[model samples]
Target: MKALSYLNKYLVKYKWYLIWGTVFTAISNLFGIFPAQLVRYALDLVRETLDTYHLYDGSTLQPALYSIFAFSLLLFAGGTLALALLKGFFLFLVRQTLIVMSRHIEYDLKNEIYDHYQTLPLSFYRQHNTGDLMARISEDVSKVRMYVGPSIMYGVNLIVLFILVITYMVSINARLSAYVLLPLPILSVLIYLVNNIIIRKSEEIQASLSKMSTYVQEAFSGIRVLKAFVQEQQSAARFEVESDTYRAKSLSLTKVDSLFFPIVAILVGLSNILVVYIGGQEIIAGRLTPGNITEFILYVNMLTWPVMALGWTTSQTQRAAASQARINEFLNIKTNIVSKKDINRSIQGEIDFRNVRFVYPDSGIVALHNFSMHVKAGETVAILGTTGSGKTTLANLLTRMYDVSSGEIRIDNTPIVDYNLTSLRSQMGYVPQDVFLFSETISNNVRFGRPDLPQARVEQAVRDADLYQNVIDFPEGFDTAVGERGVTLSGGQKQRLSIARAIARDPRILILDDCLSAVDTNTENIILNNLRRIMADRTSVIISHRVSSAKLADYIIMLDEGTIVEEGTQAELMARNGAFRELYEKQLQTEEV
Candidate 1:
């Protein structure tokens, strides 16, 4: 019910279509029932004509038999045929409107989920898997579409047809109608029991499918690791376990369905039997005509398939209910990184952190503690830190990727949270260690943030990142494809492309989070020289473990266990012989520089 209410917000625009479609459905069902009523009329006509007052008794003209029977019978046949064709036309319109509405709803719901995902903090993603999320957005949402469309259409249709058929049957002979409906209470009890089991089984099947999807996604994403370790057999065995679980759950749901349909068939069959016996007795007692019995029998036969459809509708509704719950889970999550209300300030290069602290959710480990820093506009600051020393966490906090646990961060002397999220991030060009490039031409990747960037600016950023020579060497030059995640490029080439993308943004603050590590000394030097000119009038924060990179900073801060333990020029830090000096010595030895 909650899911239905949530989805209803998307349906307000389609109310007209839903209303008209329902009207057409009721009209079509009436057309379908018209022929059955004709059967009753025709049967009565034949009986009356052959009665003691008619042709067989010579009380009526023989010519009246041919005229009345031929004209009435032939006319009803053509009328019934015409009505059936008209019903088909109305059914098409009904489906075109309602089914199309469901499709639109599906499209909107999927995009809504994806947009919500984008707003959610990275922490949420850490707790969820890609494949499970994919299952919810794709398969689960599709199931809900079925509930809104065909199931509702058929369910309403059956109701209209059933009411008309049962009402007319009672008018023919109320006692026979009552008897035919006797097994109904029992069928109702069976549906209640069977529906509960089907709902439970549907939840299980969807869950198993999501888990299996997650396993398959992970296996392929890490296939290189599996082959390197010769773990193909192990991976396949694990996948087999998931597949078997999915199969078992599906068959269990099928088993519930298997029991359900037969019960419905038997109940419908019982209704036919009651009509046959009780209705036959009414004819002999002369309380009812043979036409009424025959008509009642046709009505029961017409009802059989709808009784079967009841079970199907029940199963689909239950499955759709289960799917709705899964989709709602994602839709209802409160965002952890929402932008501050009424705040949309532009950024300048100056940045400050005042006694800030941060801890990862679900992990007790503190990433930052009482961290304070101040950087003036138009200055370059280098952060040297060991692994897990809160360098990346600090950068993330500045961007409001995850808000600070305590204290505050400021940009341009204003609180960081005082700016709009999009506006705040737009001020800085951040290139992280892992560069993810889309499968597109070199020019497109470079101008990702600004699709309308002029060609000259893009080429200039490429030259600044020391990648122009490489880009031009390719046969297609700037148009060459990068493949998935830039797989076609070497590590250094990928990093240079990342730098080019950042440089193209031309923001007030530039952050390179160890982005130069993959490049060799000469290439790194050339990139740094280019960045030096770009950072001359903007604030730049360089996070690296390299002593060579740190030496060029106006000032350097070395982090140890989430605290700034050393702050000085590179020469001063080396002279003090602290952890920063030790790191510089080790890197120098490794590179033999």
Candidate 2:
């Protein structure tokens, strides 16, 4: 019922076609009953002649026999042709309309889901697997489409056919119809019970399938690691477990299907027996005309399809219901982040955090607490921190990935939340710790941040990021394809491309979050020098563990356990002999040795 409600909007549009299709079905059934009446009438005429051979005129039977034969032949031929045409036309229109509606619904749902995903906090992705989310968007949404297209239409057709058949039967002979329909109520009850089981089992099956999809995606994505570590056998075994679970659930569903069909057959057979036995008795007792009896039997036969269809419809409806529930659940998940409608008028590069605190939605421990920072416009500041010292958390706060649980963050004298998200993000260029590239050409990847920039400008940015020579070395130059996640490129090349993307944006605030770590000292120095010259007027935040990188900044802040323990110039911090000095001394010793 709930699933049907989801499809009501489309159903309303095509209801007229359904009504006419059903009328044609009823007309076909009526014409089908005539042949049986002819048979019974011929049998009666023969019996009459046998009783009075001498008195009966053989000529009198000819016209009646001829009329019966002609009427049956014409009705059967015409009705069959008309039914075929009607069914074809109706089914064609309905299927095409459903396809269109499904496509439109899919478009709307995908856009809505994607838009919601964009607004959701980073914490959501941290807890959820990429494969599972992809499955929901692609596979689960497809299930909803299937339900809307075929399942809803067929289910409604079955119900309408059943009601029409039952109404015709009751009008012909109420008692006989009641006796034949005894099994129908029982069948309905049985279907109800099966539907409950099917829904539960279908949900379990879909869940297992999702897990299988996730496992396959993960294994294939990490195939290189599995082979390098000789974990191929282990990976195969794990995949087999997930696959076997999927097969088991499918088999269980089939078992339920096996039981369903047999029960439906039995109930239909019982209905046939009641119609034949009771209607035959009426003929013997002369209480009913033979033609009438034959018509009743024909009606019973015509009704078998609708009865069978009822059972099949029940199964499809249950599966669709389960799918709808899953789809709706995903659609209903609210995004943790919300953007304001108004844009901040003056968004200078100045950024300030006043005792801001944050914890991941699923975690109890706070990632950042009482973290205060102030940066003036056009200042190149370096943040030095150990692993898990809240450096990334601080960067995320600047972008409002997770809103502060307490205190506030302000940008250009306006609260961060006051600015529209698009406007706020446009003012900043962020390079993440991990550089991700699309499987596209080199030029496309470089120009990703500012797609509308002139080609010459993109070439200049590529040169500034120290990647122009690398790009030219490829046979296809800028047109060379970067494989998935830039797998074709070396680590340093990927990092350099990421830097080029950020530099192309030309944002007011440029943030490089340890983006230079993959490159060697010489390449890093070249890139840093280029960035310093290009981004001299921009407010820059450089996050790194290396003191050499920190030394390039105007001022340095050393973070420890989510707190700023030391803040000074590089020379002053080294003189004080704190965490930065200790890290610098260790690197110097490694270099000397």
State the weakest 10-residue window (summed lDDT) of model 1: 52-61
RMSD of each: 2.1, 3.5
Tens-place lDDT per residue, model 2, 1-593, is 67547656645665554455445444444444445545555556655544554454566876676566566556656655665566566556655554565666767667777887776778888887776778777777777766665555565556555576677667767878888888878988988888788888988988887788888888877777878999989888998998899899989988887777788788878877887788788768776666666666666676676667666667767776776676667667777566665674546698888998887677866877688888888888999888888888878888778889898998887788888887788778888888899999988987787788888988988898899999999999999999988989998999889988888878888888988889888888898888888668888899987777875698898888788899988889889988888988997787677
Alpha-carbon lDDT, every model = 0.85, 0.77
TM-score of each: 0.95, 0.89
Model 2: residues with Cα > 4 Å off, grouped in runs: 2-76, 98-100, 287-294, 344-346
Report the C-alpha displacement of residue 296, candidate 1, in angstroms. 1.8
Compared with the true structure, model 2 gives a TM-score of 0.89
> How do the residues 339-432 of candidate 1 rate in per-residue lDDT, one tens digit apiece?
5664776666898989999988857679988999899998889998878888888777876788888999988888877788887787789888
Clashing pairs in 2: none
- lDDT value, residue 139 of candidate 1: 93
Prediction 2 global C-alpha lDDT? 0.77
